[model samples]
Target: MQDTTMAGLWALGLGTVKAQSTVTKTMNASIPTLVVLANLPQLALSVIYVLVNRLLSAMAAAREWASFAHSRKGLRVTVPQGQQRSTLWLQLPYSFAIPQLVLSALLHYFVSQSLFLAQIAIFNARDETEDGGASVSSIGFSAIAIFCSLLTTGAVLVAVVLAGLVVRSEAEDGT
Candidate 1:
């Protein structure tokens, strides 16, 4: 199952690279470098997420077991009183991270586009052109940056969505 998840991640990476490659005929090899730079932080976040989630899940399981044990011993089980306690270890910045992921994506896109446009302006600064219709200044999208940013934003979004689902499942199971 872990292998499957890793494989899916790799596929997602490849797909994003391939999708962005459609924009220009620049160096295709640059994709990997940008991807690595952009994803390093997210990789750390992913590891933290998995570790903390496992810890919380174990605690929840232990609490459930203890309650069951007490009930089997003919003692009444006290409902796990703290609603916030259930999520203590695994609380994500849902209010912030969700919108942050989305906004970061859009911002990254614009930044990348601006860089590409700047590059175009630089190339055209000498008034050089292939078809003579216009200079390279018209290019408006930095393909690599956009791709990398999207990759990162995508990872965060997936994590957030999965976190929401797990929280919901845990709640439902407890009830």
Candidate 2:
């Protein structure tokens, strides 16, 4: 999991570099380095969110597994207020989850759109005469854009499910 997160961060950094170069080359303007670096904090925050959530989830799962294993060993396992207590170790951020999810989805959508537009601009800059049609490069970029859009959409849907889980958990807590 840590490896995956690190890889994700690395990929995001690479993508930022590519995006910066593409935008500069296509738009024929000098994009400030800060423009690329500004997104790093948000990306880092996303990574932190993933890490913390996964870590908490793993802890909860480990607790459950250990309890089951102990029970199987013929030892009496005492659960504290097992009926009322939550098995989950980490509480979901009820108030901020939806907003964060929406922001993340929007960020992804805008970034993908920006990339798509940059590709189109590059195509136009290369072939000034051709118009109103798709070239191979444009098509390729379009496919990537579509994939990014779909990925973000899927993430948003997952957030919706997580939001539901948070609400259900709160209800279970009789809050």
Candidate 3:
């Protein structure tokens, strides 16, 4: 329980950090359109939600492992040769979740950048069809990138929900 609590606190701290960073960036940014700023709050909320929930999942796993190691269900993870054999079903939330979230965040950021660029490109393309910029190509690429971003974020959200389930089970078992 101590371990889980500590881990949860750390998770909360990291989640706060992610939220603060998003707010900081949004404040410093100079987006001209309300549409761009409109997206920031939702994205930042997502990062905070995922980070906190996933971290709690990881903490639950850790606490369960630690308790299993200490108590006797007649299960010793390590062998007589002093080989540690635990962590069979453990999933490090940060290992998978954080990177996925970061990647998704980056892609969203770029998605907006691409849209802005594409808008400018459209203006230019109308005036000059043969503009040397990779304008049209970028539009296609960014569309694909945004699709992939949604896919990744959706997957992560599902994983986090499952992780939360595991954590809840651990809590019930702990009692």
lDDT digits (tens) for residues 100-127 of candidate 3: 5575566555445323311223335367
Q: What TM-score does structure 2 among the candidates reach?
A: 0.29
| Residue 104 in candidate 1, Cα distance off native in Å | 2.3
Report model 1's TM-score to 2 decimal places. 0.30
Local distance difference test, candidate 3: 0.47
TM-score of every prediction relative to native: 0.30, 0.29, 0.37
lDDT of candidate 1 over 2-113, digit per residue (tens): 2335444455333233323233444343544544544454465556546645554554555445555334423222344533233332233344345544655554453444
Stretches > 4 Å off in candidate 1: 1-115, 119-136
Q: Provide the overall lDDT of each model, using Cα atoms, as 2-decimal numbers.
A: 0.45, 0.45, 0.47
Question: Which scores higher on TM-score, 1 or 3?
Answer: 3
Highest lDDT model number? 3
- The total of clashing pairs for model 1 equals 1
In model 2, pairs of residues that clash are none
